[model samples]
Target: MYVAAKGGEKAIANAHRFLAEKRRGNPQLPEMSVEQIREQLGLAVDRVMAEGSLYDRNLAALAVKQAQGDLVEAAFLLRAYRTTLPRFSPSPVVDTGSMRVLRRISAAYKDLPGGQVLGPTYDYSHRLLDFSLMEPEAFAANVVYLVDKMIALPSRIPRLTEIVGSDDLVETPQEEPDQDPPVPDITEEPLEFPASRSARLQALARGDEGFLLGLAYSAQRGFGFQGHPFVGEIRMGYVPVEVELPGEDVKVRIGSILVTECTMLSRAEETGGCPFGFVQGYGLVFGANERKAMAMALVDRALRSRELGEEVRYPAQDEEYVLRHCDNVESSGFVQHLKLPHYVDFQAELVHVRRRDVKKSQGADDQGPSSVGSAGEG
Candidate 1:
C-alpha cells in the first residue's frame, strides 16, 4: 500500500508536467503571449476581470493563459490573486453620465439628442466564421488602419434616461438626503438574509455569466414579474476613476477604465398620488461585457419585488436564492470537491449495511418452523 501511494504521488507530478507540455503544444509556432490574449481575445479577458471583481487587463490575460482558456477557471485564479492585494480606500462613485462614450445605443427611441453610435459590435455581422483570420498580418494591418482613420467619438453623450425624463415618462432617481446612508459592503461582511441593494448589486456584478443569463431568461419568460422591459440605453466607454485622500476635500484622478453600462426600463404600477410610469434597473461592470450587464439589469429589476410591489414567487425575485447561489467560485469549489477520496466514508457505510443485514437474517432464522407453518396455513 505504501508503494502504491508513492506511485500515485509520482503519477500526479508527471500528470502536471504533461499538462504544462500540452499547454505549450508547438515549439515551431510562436508562443502565445499575454499581450496577444489581451489584444486579440479581449472578450475573454473582460469576462475574467468582471467575474473576478478585478479590473487589471494584464493579470486577467495571464490568468486566462494559465487556466488553459477555461474562462471560469481563469476568473477563479484572478479572484484568488485579488484576495492577496492590500486594501485601499474605495474610489469615488462613478459618474456614468460623464463617461467618454465609444458606443451608445437606445432601443427606446430611434432619434435622441445624441445619435446612436454602434462601435465594435457583432450585432449586425454575419455569423459565419472567417477563415481569413489564419493570415494574421493582413487582418491586423487593415484593422489598425481602419481604427486610425476613424473619428474620435464625442466626449459626452446624453443618456436615453435623461431624454425620457424630459417628457416625464419615467421616474427619475431620488436625490441623496442630507445624511448619506451607510452602504453595505458584501465582500467585508458575511452575506445575511434581506440584503441591501448595494450588496445585491455587488453579488450580481461578480456572478457567473451563464447562471445570471439563465435566471434573466427565466424571469423574462413569465417566471417573475414579466414586465415589458426595454433597453433604455447600453453604453460602453472609459470613465475616469477618482479617489479622495485622507483629510482632504479634493479628489485626485486615479486612472480610466473601460466599462459597459445598461439601463433597463420596465412597466411600473400606479400608486397613491403617482401615475403609472416606467421604473429603471441599472447594471455596470468592468470592460465590454454587454450581455452580462444586460442580464444583470434584468435580474436586478426582478429582485425589486418588495420595492416595486410585485409578487416574489420566482427564484429571481428571491434575494436569498439568487445572491446565495450566484457566486461561481463557491459553487464550483463545492462541486469539484466531490472528486476527493471517499474510501473511508464508503467503508464505514459498508460495515453498517452488512451488520444490519446479518441481524435481519438471524431474526428470520430464530423464527421456529412451527411458526412458519402456522403462518403459511393462515
Candidate 2:
C-alpha cells in the first residue's frame, strides 16, 4: 500500500509569488521594459526564438523578462504560448539566395561575386571587458554607426557551391527530376526513426545550442567523419516569407524576417570514374546565430551517414539518438521534474530497503553462534 503527500497548493502559490518578487528586484530602479530586452538583449532574444521555434521578437522578449533571463525557461514559455496560436496557413519555402545582403562571407573562396561583407560581427573583437558600459551614455556612444554614403549592393549573390560545382569540383544539391516531394512537418507528426531530411533540419533548427555545438566538436574530433570541411558561405539577412492561399494560383509575401544561413562543404570520395568532389550540408536559423547555424550544418552532415554510405559509429551519426534527445522542451521537463515531491515513491523504496536489511540481519544471527563456537574451538 502507498500513501500520497498533500497540502502543497498554498506553498506552491507562495513559491510562485516569491519567484515573481525576486524576478523584479530593486523596485526603486527603473523597470526593464520589453522593448529594451528586444533591442538591447537582442542576441538572447534571438536564441530564445531559435530554440522555441517561434519567430516573434516581442513575445520572445516578454518570455525573457518573465523567465528572469533564463534562456531555457524563456524558450519554454514561448513554446507554450506558440501552441495557443491559431494555425492559418503554411508558409512557402524561403529562398536563401535572394536574401537582402546584410553580412556575407565564404571561407572556400578568396572573394565571391558580391564580395565578402563582414557586417556587425564580434569575430575580431578584443575579449577584454569594457567596464565603461556601466555608464549608459558610454554604451550608446560605442554602438553608434554612421553610414557616410549609400552604396548599392548586387541584387543577388551567387552561392559558392555553384562556383565550386561549375568546375565539377563539388556536387550541387539537386532534387529528383521526376518527383517533387512535399517536406514533412515535424510539428504536425511525431518524429519517427530514420527521419526525413526535412524533419532532421527542423529538429536541428530548434536544438539546444550548446548540445549541438558539443556534438559538432565531437564530430570534428574524429568521432564521426574526419573530412576537412570548409564553410562555403555564411549569410545573414532578411528574406520575405510567402504563403499560398487555398485554391489560389498565386502566393503572397506575408512579411520579412532575419535569418542566418550556412553552407558547409566536405570532400567526397571519388568512385566509378567520377572526379573527387565536395558534398554539402546546409543550415538555416532565425536571426544572426552564426554558431548555431555552423553547428547545425556539421551535425546535419554527420546525421546523413546512411544516405551517404558512411559507417555510423558516432552518436551524432545516429538519427534516432540525435532527434530523440535534441528537443530542449522535452529534455528540460524531465530534468526539472526532479524538483517535484516524490514522498510516496521514496517511502516505498525505504520500506523495501528496511525489509531486505532485516532479513539479512536475521540470517546473519542464525549463523553467528555456530560460526563463533567453531572458531573458539579451533
Candidate 3:
C-alpha cells in the first residue's frame, strides 16, 4: 500500500505564492493588460491558440499573461482550461479560396493572378535595428496608411493548385464515391498508424513549430526527399467561419479568423500507379505564421512518401514518430517530470552502485596495495 506524505503542502503553497510575486515584477510599472497582449503580442497569442487547439483570442491572451510570456506554458494552461468547456458540434469546412487576401505570394512564377501582395512582413527589412522606432515621434502615423493606395483584391482568388490541377500539371486526388473518406479528428480519437492523411494533417496543424521547422529543413536538405520544393503559393488573410444549425439544414457565418496557408509542389514518383506529374502538399494554420505554414507543407509532403510509393528512409517520412512526438505539451511533461522526487528508486540505485564499488575494492585489495593504488589512479 502507498502512503501519502504529509507536511509539504504549506511549502508547495508558499512556492506558488512566490512564483506569482515574481511574475508581477517591478511594482512601479503598470501591470500589462490582457488586451495589450492580445493586440501587441499577437504572434504569441496565435501560437498558444494553435497549439492548444482552442480558438479564443481573449483566453489565449489571458493564458500568455498568466504564464508570464512562457508560450508553451500558456498553451498548456489554455489546453487545460479547454477541457472544462462543453464541445458543441464541429464547424463547417473553411474556404480559403474565398479568403480576404491581405497577403499572397508565389515562388513558381514571377507574377500570377491576384499579384504579389506583400503585407506586414520583415522579409525585406535589414537585420540592424532602427533607433527611430524607439522615439515617441515614430508612433505618429499607423502603417496601414502606406497600403491605402494599393487596390483591393477580389472576394475570391483562384488557388494555384486548382489552376495546376486543371492544366494536368499536378496529381489531383479524385473525389470519387469510394475515394472520399471522412476526415478523422486527432483530438477526438487516439492516433494510430498507418494514419490517414487527414489525421496526419490534423496532428501537424497542432504540432510544435520549432520541431516541425527542424524536420522540414532536414527533409529539404536531402534527409527524406531530394531537391527543393517550390512554394506554389502562400496566402494569409481573414477567412469566414460557419457552422450548420443542428436539424435546421442551414449554415450561418458566425465569425472570421486570420489564417495562413501554403501549398508546396514537388516531383511525384511515377511508380505510385499514377502518371508522372507534380504532387502538392497543403498547410493551413491560425494566424499569420508563414514560417510554420511553409514548414508544415514541406513535412506534409515528406510524410506522404508511403502513399506516393517512395522509400521511408528518414525520420520525416515516419508518421508514427512525427505525430507521437509532435505535441509539445506531452513531450515537455515527460521530460520535466524527472524533477519530481524519486527517493526509493534512487536509493536502490545508490545501494547497487555502492555494492559494486565495494566488490571492486575487495578484488583490488586481494591484488595488494599496488593494484589498489593503480586502480585509484587510473
Candidate 4:
C-alpha cells in the first residue's frame, strides 16, 4: 500500500547522484581542479605525504579530494596506492648536507657557520581565523625567497649510517654495508627483539599524526624529561633520487620528491654521562611536516640512552613503548573497538548485581530484631 517501499534502491542511487553533484558543485562555477586542490589544500597534501610515505603532490591532492578532505583518510589512500606499486631497485642516498635547502634552522648553535633561516613556516603566525576566505578572492600576501647553508643527509640505500659511526665525529668503519634489502620489513615481517631505529622511524613516519603529537606532547609535559630540544634543522625541498645499476657500480636518478628532514641537536641530561652530552635526534618524513619531524626528533634522542650505555628509565626511553604503538591502523582499530556493542552482556551483569543486592537487603530486613539485639548485646 505504501508503494512496497520499492523506492529505497532508487533513493540510494539518487542520494549518491546528489552527493556527486554536490561534490562537483555548480557546473557554471569554477570546478575544483586537482591543481587548485594541490595549491589551496596543500596542508592536506603534506599530511598525506607525511603518513603516506610517498611524495607525489598531485596524487596526494587527488587523495584529499577522494577522501572528502579527511587528511588521515587521504594519507591512508596514498599509502594503499603506494603499497601496490612495483619496486625495481633501491635508490642512491641523497646527501642532505649538500642539499639546496629551502628552510634551514639550527638550535644547537645560533651562530653556527650557517645561520637559521625559517622559510614558509606558520610558527609565528597568529592563531586568528580569517573569515574573509569566505569569498576566497581576498587572500594575497607577499612571498619571500632566500638561499643558504648545507648539511649532509643520509639516504636509505646502502645503510649509510655505518658511514658515520655512533656519535663519534670520526670513526673507522670495517667496511660499507653491502648493497642489499633492508634488514627488517615490519610491514611484511613480525617485529622481534632489539628493534632497529630504522624500523622504528619507518613506523613512526607513517604513523597517525595526532597520536604522534600526543606521545610527543607527553615528553614535553615531563613524562620523560631529559633535555630541551632545539630545531637543529628542518628542510623542505626536492632531492634527486637514484637507483643503483644491478650488477654494476653505476647509479641513476630515478626521480625527485619533496621531503621534510628534521635533526634535533639536544644536550643529553647528566644521568650517567658528563653533566651534558651532545646528542642528535633525527626525523625524516615525506612532506613539510616540521612539527612531526621535530617531535620525532625529541623522542628519538630520549630513546638513545640505552644505546649510549646509560640506563633507560622512562617509558619514552623504551624502544618498544614508542615503536609498538606508532601504527595508525593498529592503534585506531584497538581504540575504536571499544565502541562495539556489549550491552547484552552488560544487561545480564546488571540483573545479577541487582538480584544479589535485593537478597542481601531482604536478609538485613529480617535481621531488624537482630539490630535491636546488637544494641543490647553491645
Candidate 5:
C-alpha cells in the first residue's frame, strides 16, 4: 500500500523542536559546555579533528556536543564548516625533528639516542577503570614537573630515519631540488587513478580511523601483505607552524599544534639483486592520535605494493578502493540517506513483488493438483 506525504513544513519544525528537547535531556542537570568537552574529552576531539581534516579543537568539541557524541557526524559537521572558511597561504613543512617531545617510543630499538621517553601514554596503565575519576582529586605537582621537563627538553632530537638514512637500508625517496613537482593538494582536486605517493598520503591522513585500523590489521594478517612490519618510531608532541605571507621574504611562526607521527619499516626486496632490506612508510596526523597515525602508516605501506613490486590482490593494497571509501563523511552520508523518505521507491518495489506472486499463483492454478501429481510421478 502507498502512503501519502503530509504536514511537510510544520511537521519538520515540530520534529526539530522535539529533537532539541530530547538533546537537552533532564533540565535539572547542568548543560555541558564546549570548553569542558574540549579539555575533558580530548581524545574524542582529537579524532574529530584528524578525520575532519581541521585542527581547531574548540570547534571539533562543539561539533561533538552538537552531534551527541556521534564521532562521524561530528567530523561531518567540522568538514562542512571547513569548506566555508577562506583559504590562507599554505604553511611551511613542519619539522617534527624539532618537536617538543611529549611521548616517544620505538618498537624497533630499545636503546636509541633519545632513550625512549615515555612522556604521557596509556600503554603502561592497567585496563581497569578508576571509579575515583567520577570525582577526581586535586592535581598534583608531579604533573607540573612533567610539563616543565617537556618544555626544557632539547629543541632537536635526532630522527631515527636520519640515523638509518646513510646506511641506505630503507627505500627513502628524496626530493630533487628545483626538479621535483609540487605535491598535489587532494582537497583542491578530485582523487584520480594512479595517484602520486603524496596524494595518497594526503588522503590517508584524513581518512576514518576505524576503517584504516581494520585495513591495517588485515594487512598484518596476510592479506596482500608480506612479512611483519616494525614500528620504527612513534612520537607525539607540539610542532611549531610557520608561514611566509605573500610579498614577504621572512617567515613567521604561527604557533604550535599537537601532532602524532609514526614511521613503519617493512621488508623490501633490494634493487639489482642486492640484499633484502626495510622500506619505511610514514604517517602524520593532527593532535595526539597515535592509533590513527600507526594505522595510516600501515595502510600507506600496503598501498605501496605496486611500487615495491609486490602482488596487489587485496582491498588494503588497492589505492582506489581505500582512498574512495575511507572518507567517513561521504560514507556516512550515503549510508544514512537511506533513512530519508523512500515512499515512491518502496511502492514501486512492492508492486513488482505483488505482480510476481500473482503470476506464480496463476501458473500453479493452471497446472492444478492432477498436474502436480503427474509431474511428481514423471
Candidate 6:
C-alpha cells in the first residue's frame, strides 16, 4: 500500500473536505461571522496582513478560518487572494510623515516632533489565557478615546530626505539613491540574486512572519548583527499610492495601503574602494508589522553591501540567505510535499548502493581467505 502510486485526485478532494469540516465544526451551532474573527482574533489577522501585504480584515479572517488558525497558511491564502485582485493605479506616494498612525513608537527619541503614539497594540497584553469566554457575552461594549490629528507634523510639507540627508557628513549620494523606482512583480517573476532594494523589500513584505522573525533573531543572536540596529522609528498606518494615468499630467490617489516601514542605522564602513558612508537599512511590509519590517530592514542593508562590492562575512548579510528563506509558501510546500511519491529516484539509489556493496564483497572474495586479516571500512 505504501509503495502504490497515490490516488492523488481523490485524496486531495477528501483532504479538502476534511479541512472544510474542521474549519466549520458543528454546523448546527450558530455560524461564526468573519467580523467576529477579525475583531477578536486581531493579532492573527494583523500578522496575515503584515505578511500578505493586504489590510482587508474580512478576507484575512476568512483566510485564518480556512487555514485552521495556521498563521503561515493564512498568510499564503491572503497573498493568493490579493494577487487575484485587480491592480488600480498606485495612490500618490502617501507620505509616512502624514500617516494617520494606529501605532507609532521610536527608540531613537523619547520625545520627538510626533510624540510617540502606541495606538493599538497587544504587546502590553498578558499572555495568560482566558477560560471564561466559553460562554456568550451579554452585550457588546464601546470604548472611548480623545481625537487629535497630525498635531506633530508641520503644516508645510518639507522634503523628508533633505532633513536626514545632511547627517551623514561623508561622501554623499549625488542625489536620492532611490528615486522614482520601478516596482517588480514577485508573483510573475522568479526571484533573482542581487535583486534591487525595491524587489527585496516587496519579497519581504509578502514573506512569512515567523520566518522573518527567526532570521532577524538569528542576526541579533550573533549570526550577523555586527551593526546593532536602532529602530529609527516603527510606524504603522495607511499610505496613499499614486499612479499616473494615460492622459493625466498630475498623479492621482489610486488607493491607500497599510504599511509598516522600518529604517535601521549602520555606521560608516569602508568597503572595496569606496569611502565610508551611513548605510540606510529600509524595510516595508504590507501592514503594521514593525518587528518584521525592522528585521527586513537589517537584512536589506546587509544584502545591499554585497551588490556594492562589499565582502559578505555573515549569513544574514547575504541577500540570498535572507530572501530565499523568508518565503514560507515556497519552503513549506517544497518541504511538506516531499512526502508524496518519488520512489523512482529512491529505487535507483537503492539499486546503485546494492551493486556497490556486491562489488566490494567480490573485491574482498578476490583477496581469498587472507581477507580474514584485512577487513576494510565500507
When 3 and 5 are scored with lDDT, the better candidate is: 5
Give every collision pair in model 4: 96-151, 96-153, 97-151, 97-152
- Any residue pairs clashing in model 3, and if so which? none
Model 6 RMSD in angstroms: 4.6
Computed on alpha carbons, the lDDT of every model, listed in order, comes to 0.85, 0.85, 0.85, 0.69, 0.86, 0.70
CA lDDT of 174 in candidate 2? 59
My TM-score estimates for the predictions, one after another, are 0.87, 0.89, 0.89, 0.75, 0.89, 0.81
Question: What are the runs in model 5 whose C-alpha is more than 4 Å off?
Answer: 1-7, 137-145, 149-151, 269-276, 358-378
Candidate 3's displacement at residue 117, Å, is 1.0
lDDT of 3 at 38: 98
Q: Which stretches of candidate 6 lie over 4 Å from their true place?
A: 1-12, 88-92, 130-165, 169-174, 177-181, 270-278, 307-309, 364-378
Winner by TM-score between candidate 3 and candidate 1 = 3
The digit string of per-residue lDDT tens for model 6 on 110-204 reads 66455667877777889887554454452223333445553454332222232444554422335645566667777678888768777788887
- The candidate that wins on lDDT is 5
- In terms of lDDT, model 1 sits at 0.85
Residue 13 lDDT (model 1): 93
Using TM-score as the yardstick, the better of models 2 and 4 is 2
Predictions: Cα RMSD each: 4.7, 4.1, 3.9, 6.8, 3.8, 4.6
Tell me which residue pairs clash in candidate 2.
none
Residue 231, candidate 3: C-alpha displacement in angstroms: 0.6
lDDT of 3 by residue, 268-302 (tens): 76556446478888889888888889989999999
Scanning candidate 1 in windows of ten residues, the lowest lDDT window is 1-10
List ranges where model 1 is wrong by over 4 Å: 1-9, 141-144, 166-168, 269-276, 348-378
